[model samples]
Target: MKKRRIDIVPLTDQALALLEAIKPYSGHREYVFPADRNPRTHCNSLTTNMALTRMGLEGRLVSHGMRSMASTTLNEHG
Candidate 1:
């Protein structure tokens, strides 16, 4: 399959601020979602589950559910 080039728009002020704050929390790494062993690598499923638990959404919202919520909210606004 051929890869298509995608353009990324500039981040909003809120998004940039969130990135700045979360960078320190993630040991100054570029990726905020850190792996279990290395807080600099991409987090795996276990890490995601742990994050959900820490956020008090383990029982209430699964990953897919969260995506669905985002999709629904965006659709509703549009």
Candidate 2:
């Protein structure tokens, strides 16, 4: 195996706390967003929907829109 450098993205305190709280509920997985009523797999659609709903942008923005915004913001900062 070849050694390679990996860049680390820093998480905020709140993010860390949320992950810590979800740790026990995850059983033995590293995913923070597991499928509802089942911890075996991730539910991408459900996660996106719930997130947009909570942000009050359910009808206004989709997951792709959020990704575009994030990319634009990072590019602007960089």
Candidate 3:
């Protein structure tokens, strides 16, 4: 699974630039992948939650920590 996939409809130059920046593919898919395969293959809710608990024990981040960071960052330029 991939966290992100290419969308060709909104064919802006910026989107094309981002794809080139991350990765390049040599071929095309005959069938579109289902939505469930979006995230990294090995990352699931249980694994992420366990890691978050450990992070919290180490006085690091809690489950909702990233939400605020993303909201703040988006609000700045949103």
- Which candidate number has the best TM-score? 1
| Residue 20 lDDT (model 2) | 88
Q: Write the residue-wise lDDT of candidate 1 on 1-78 in tens digits.
A: 235767667998998999888886788776777775876587775665677889998788777777789999989999
Instruction: Write down the lDDT that model 2 would get.
Output: 0.80
Q: lDDT per residue, candidate 2, 1-78, as tens digits?
A: 235767677998998898888898777575676777676877676689687889899789888888899999989999
10-40 per-residue lDDT for model 3 (tens digits): 6579867866555423123322221235432
Candidate 1 stretches with Cα past 4 Å from truth are 1-9, 50-60
The 10-residue segment of model 3 with minimum total lDDT is 26-35
Best by lDDT: 2
Which stretches of candidate 2 lie above 4 Å from their native place? 1-28, 50-56
Q: Model 1 lDDT vs. the true structure?
A: 0.77
Model with the higher lDDT, candidate 1 or 2:
2
Candidate 3 Cα misplacement greater than 4 A, ranges: 1-20, 23-42, 49-59
For each candidate, what TM-score against the reference? 0.63, 0.52, 0.32
Q: What is the C-alpha lDDT of each candidate?
A: 0.77, 0.80, 0.53
Summed backbone clashes in each candidate are 0, 0, 0
On a 0 to 100 scale, what is the lDDT of residue 66 in model 3?
Answer: 68
- Which residue pairs collide in model 1, if any? none
